[model samples]
Target: MFLRPEDAGTVTSPTLIEAAPNEQPVLSGGVTLTGWRKDGSNRLGLPAAAQGQVWVADVPMVGGRALAFRQLWVNGRKAVRARTPNDDNLPRLLTWDVDKQEAWITATAVGTLRQAGQLEMVLHQMWAVNVLRVKTLTVQGAKVRVTFHEPESKVQFEHPWPRPIINGKNGSSAFYLTNAVELLDQPGEWHYDGQRGQVLYWPRPGETMSSAHVVAPVLETLVQVSGSLDQPVAYVQFKGLTFAYTTWLRPSEQGHVPLQAGMYLLDGYSLQQPGTPDKAGLENQAWIGRPPAGVELAGVHHTRFERCQFLHMASAALDYQSSTHNDAVVGCTFRDVAGNGIQLGKFSDEGTETHLPYNPKDEREICTNELLENNLLTDCANEDWGCVGIAAGFVRNTTIRHNEVSQVPYTGISVGWGWTKTANCMRDNRVTANYIHHYAQHTYDVAGIYTLSAQPGTTITENRVEEIGQAPYVHDPDHWFYLYLDEGSAGITVQDNWCPAEKFLANANGPGNVWKNNGPMVANAIKQAAGLEPAYRDLLAEQIKKPAANGAQVKQ
Candidate 1:
């Protein structure tokens, strides 16, 4: 059963007060309560909510309509906001007091550094940084006293980049501080002291603290519909609802390292490799582990997500995993996500490896006949730079069309699984009529459209891709392409695609792939080959009058 907001009645409850330490308020499902009061104080002091605890609201089904909450408003406004840690270029490094376990940072005033916080160092990799907590801090006239929880080790190596390397070992480097009141010197910088229950902020230029609204995401997952293979959830629909503010916490067992799309997994690596071409090191996978999503549907069938908004999420917005079929996500918007916008199917080899000579009749479980159409995905992969806008692995009979994906740090759309031409049930997928651009901005060896392994009946056609591999921070050979057919990818057709990039296609030893009329003149060639010059011309004329109609419909 599902419920929309209109089907439920609003209860006139008093403002929810924050619980004392070790106490939490339990919210039942099937009811909706606004999170804020008229006085601007949060009815729910989620900032003080304990970790790993979620305040859930259940929506009851009444007369076939499911009761739902409209939104989670905070400080009199929608609480979906940017979470990038504020940073500025490192100031001149002064002397390091080794015995004191502190480094003297040049500053104008002690201002906010008097509080405890964290220091970050990004020596080489973009997504992987070394972080150390601040134990104590002091401020002088023009220099600040900063002490780390641990002592810093220094090593030296050579790199081509001009940025200064601090505590670099074997060509690796790092340098910066964050999450401290003293370091909240730049606009948009914020820090919270859990011990004292205080939140500190430095507003952006032309902004004042009194007018700024501060919010911290308290939920890890907004919605999850999980069914087993024997009892799949069916006939569910989510329309015109805005889902936001899921949080992701870095694991304590390991250092904070993000794989593709800001997915923090137990074992992950960056796309950038160490050493020069002549002395190459081991190549790493974009992501080696999986993370959760904001809206996850597993073993679900015959469902629809239409005209929905998924934003400000710490993980993938829409993840349709194992055993999902006959589903559609149409006319939706996914932006400011820390992970992939839409992900279909789990990666092959995620579990125990099934050896070769695999039985074809062994009850293969895959998401099939899924449709992703007419959506806009942008500014995704904000935390995980290696994730794509739309990604699928071990999927079959899927259609990805008419979507506009831009400003992503990695591939726009990626399909298939397995590193080799092994038959893993990924077949008959179609990627067509999409506009993908402004990608590969952070990670490398990506494209507007990327495929892997052998998928015989797959086709890539009639897509427009531009301004790819133009990131100012990316300066490697990996930053090049429109279409990438990687490792053992074969039996695919690439035709009639309009790409004005430096390279039209990249094949990684893939065979049996057909490339025909894929370039800047592909539109004309498509018309000439199909003998529809007049119809094509008329379509172009119609497109010119309303360019927005060429892609997903922009919601009013």
Candidate 2:
């Protein structure tokens, strides 16, 4: 029944407040807009021009519409500008143009949010905010709680590229390489150990195999299978992306799984070495393999590796030499390398380059092309050791951060930039938050970290280092010592880093070096040690041996 105009005022509610023209009306009482207050008594009718700016408390109630609390209103005067809280659960639903797939969100926030297969952030009116930071992403089952910057800005996750590859493989370098190139168009699935049935790589006469087409070989040693077969190779091409491989060991029962873009799970399998150490108790299989020439692992642009493990590599775990940008290797493990564990910036002898320098001068004098970040290593000492754990030659924009290195015979992480070229070649390379321990055993001048002649502006910060010894007289002068900064390496800031120094290291006693933050933990430990030097030393020594206690740790 249609109520008379006179009777409409009976349902008056005093708690409701009305807004003047050009103002957003705020409801006073708790009984606000729920499609229930249709009575004309307290209804704040709008002028014709601003009518759409406010939703009537109950215009739709006459029909079979349910009285719901959530309603979207657009500020018609503002041209559909949106605003809402940054809380994902409390997202204020704006006037969604469903047909056009356009949403108006107010402010912007930084941090990762899950959308289908990728992790990303949302921006709204990007010019409105200054620093766009998507600081964190917390995943709770299917519910992702995102915290953002502006309460008003809305963001959309529409674009999707190929996801960056994350964990894969275990202890087998052959399997690691194979998994790295799984998406490429190869003739057959990559295989290891030829006798088990599939094609494998072995040394043959003049095979002419490109890096893309080569297969895992079965060595003639019978114990370490290294042989090559006649198989078509594949050249893998890519653009901006990241691929992280770690934690795997080959087995007869379990098969090798390929690496893909995005976060992946790795399996912990066993690796069989050819023989045991002459001194150690275990007889492990030992057939360390070497990487073929020009084998590319990472590509150009914005990649990161966190908490990865590398094992049983006859060659480098990472063979990236291209002029890449914004790449990082973080929170990873490297062990048993026949070659370098994390190899950087490839080399070519086409012109008159000769053999690649152990650490190139031209590499570090450039921009940040590669970085080794927060990586850990153990049990990497080997009889046939070839290179450092993290080696960068002729590269730039490299940062080694919060890394915990141990048990490697060679240098832990190194930078040899500008050695081939000018003195000021590498710029803005930072080695920070690293805990390098127990190194320089097999190799000498083997610092916890070494930077051969790099350019100026290379900073080493907040590194807690221990157990690095001077190289024996017989080893190359380049191989021994802790914190080796040689060959015109200046503007180097060694600040706030801990090291077990027999004495202060002096390189030619030149003037330009900056040593700001240098100290030892023993002094601090002695304070807590309550005057017992032996007890304090023993306790501190034990803590340093454990991986969890030693490195620059990522706070949860």
Candidate 3:
């Protein structure tokens, strides 16, 4: 996701140096660009001299990771397709038309879009391209000028250049492409002091005595800032807004079971597509409700919880650890969870199960930098019965993608920590393409993507397991089997997955475990428990290309 072949500039006349070559036009990069113009208009970048439509309403929606388009010119050479709106089809919006260079694109074809009118270009090829929408945004004084209204669409804007702040606080602001639409239409008092470059406010909704300040919920205005420079907003979208109470109450001594997320903004919506269900997950339930015993919990960051649905929560419907980061709990759905639906570490009972074997001075640990992608868990545990769908330990570099665990009961995807000793506890974690199934058996452990006593580059890839047993014979399976390694853990890589094996099980050692190139019912017990022989089992049976199917699907 990096494109920069000579900063191509020029909407009708933006600039990067041009006077020759047919009124000076150069955008050659790979092409498939568009802004909007079939009578909609949006090719923004103004301030060199500013003009018209308030120069596209003073262009100001910027956030990054790639969603750039600048001088794209390609008219009759053909080869620039774009048409995808959801289902992860990928492609938000794009258009270009600088004096008849003619471009027309939508997004999500993957590659190919290089025209020849203004000289368009765009060769992404695949992967990485989240969401990039633009209504109108410009800042010539700080450079960010683009404007186009259909004539033809191509795209341009290359190399590290996407920074336009103005989210919310007092002096209201909203309009971001890379990310700007979490629910903030108005409210005031937000300043960045880099010489008046970032400011937001509205301050008149409820008047409020104005001293302690903090009122979030904007998408049609409701902001109230004070002064306290804070930054952590990559993407947030919550509509049907509701932000309440915020937390601060203490009275728990004899038997503590209290935790707080200290809500500032909960139940937010942001252009959520794919069969709409966001309103904090269908009909508002956004909460922060309990906090008293010492009060100090703040949650929700890098927000996005589509199709949100919850019930009876004890905690962790989506609790971002302390100083949150990179959060994304897409297509959410949880039910009757007394606790544990999506907890990326921290919010302790030391680690549930009523303090499990974990009892470190009452425990109140921390681990953030969250991400629980594509979620959906069901019937979580009740009455503090200990349930875990996605639980990390002292979290680090978290990423749990394409999720879909089922009828929860205990352990479906648990990583790191049996207690807190801490030392790079959970490093570079990634539990990808998940779809764990029916968990219920506990009484000790119910494994399926479970790792404990943490350590060693954890990565459990390409997951898919079936109805993990609950009875009949007490099945219970999944690697590391029962790791402890004196509570330090190590380099775990259980690759190319597909589960459902019940018979031979007995590797509770937990010392430097490795089961490389995994696939095919644990591939001969990971070569006889890492003793390795029989020519490494024909080199792990020639890397077992893909023959372990049983069940897994969320794809809705």
Candidate 4:
């Protein structure tokens, strides 16, 4: 909570903070971590096979630093960050060099892996993801090289395209090393140690560390709502809210590259002078950065967020962050967000240049008419596997309809940004009858309604988009699709979308695009009229933690 604005000027009136009718109100940014003194988990350095099953704590510092978060939340779920091929296996990546940003790992003793610069690898790269940070691991014969650190290791080896592909397509590219206190031997696993501010659990089953309930996330952006573009921040309204705990430590401070729906990648490169008047021999050059939002509006306008409930955030859960206009996120309910569950408008503003094309001479900086209807995005980009469940960049008339999005990992409704097929500032965007299902769950060249650049009266109609989740550590399991209009998808208008065959992916599209009557003979009344519209279908049984008396939704 930056705590400034106590009359620091500029708030041209018009604000109304709802929720008193059936009371929802939960806006927390977490910080409850009482004393918790258990100590000795092998003197708290934990490694002799988790030295008598880890459990130690003392962190708690708050305003004076050292609470060290990476997501904890004990009493109400989420707690397993000691990672290292734990459970979901995740290892392969036996050689890479992208000019020495290094990575070898076939694995072997490798000097018993201890802190090693607070370790954190998480590399899985097919369509973006590059955590890195290790900086030295050596053994190099039967493998285990690793390297990286500085400036995200030169922006993850000269950032070209969602990078880190070694062999390509379903092969050498899956990783996960994570915050190791020597991977704290199982039981719900944990570990934080920010150089001994300590905290190292291992409880699970009937946990009881003197009345359990931890909680760590200490604010990244709880509810900003600032104003500018000529004193905006107009008629604000936030009905029945819930937005909970937030924290996205900037990939533990400097080392997270991403360049797709999740947006990180502070500075990408590759452009030896690649054309781009409307994109032709265009050489990438990204800039992105915007993740951190548990409700963060900016230069707002007719603001509105009905039935709100973007839960447990660590990154992007409701962010109309730009000169937002006629805002409206109808029946909101983005679950367990880790990144992107509705991040409409402007995706290249860390200094612009994300392939240019974002024309704005003050059309109020352009995020016009936004309105995501019947929303209920579930699970949501769980720990940023390249986030997306409705991420709309450089928006104009945005109006995604009947939203239903499912468990999501990568791309389940992402719309235009400047990959450029010319024509800037986007146009009349509108993805209709949305239902997008299971989704790539882990990263692929994704698409269940994906798009990029040039949007002139955009229209992806009657979307039902089927299952599509088969993650076995993807690089490209048959690429993936069900409406992907990537790279300069111009003047869009894809018709009657259903999906179960006729796959769909129009990669370098441009010039008045249009594809009619999409897939499986498109019928069944357009796949039963897409999703969530019978007055929001009770938000498809909404839930981030809904349980008592059968509310359901805590399964993913």
The top-ranked prediction according to TM-score is: 1
Model 1, position 187, has a per-residue lDDT of: 36
What TM-score, computed on C-alpha atoms, does each candidate reach?
0.64, 0.39, 0.25, 0.36
Tens digits of per-residue lDDT for model 2, 84-166: 12122222212334234333322222112232111112221100101112223345553333332221111111111111111
RMSD of 3: 26.1
Query: How much is the lDDT of residue 146 in candidate 2?
Result: 39
By summed lDDT, the worst window of 10 consecutive residues in model 1 runs over 543-552
Candidate-wise lDDT, in order: 0.55, 0.35, 0.34, 0.77
Model 4 over residues 16-90: C-alpha lDDT tens digits? 567787655576777666556555535544666666656677787766877667888777677888877775557
Give me the runs in candidate 3 sitting further than 4 Å from their true place: 1-133, 137-316, 320-341, 346-364, 367-393, 396-423, 427-454, 457-490, 493-497, 500-513, 516-518, 522-556
Q: Residues 499-525, candidate 1: write the lDDT tens digits.
A: 774375555535678888787877654
Candidate 2 displacement at residue 175 in angstroms: 32
Q: How many clashes in each structure? A: 21, 73, 70, 1
Task: Rank by TM-score, highest first.
Answer: 1, 2, 4, 3
- Give the CA lDDT, 0 to 100, for residue 373 in model 2: 52
Off by over 4 Å in 2: 1-295, 346-369, 381-383, 418-421, 469-479, 502-511, 517-556
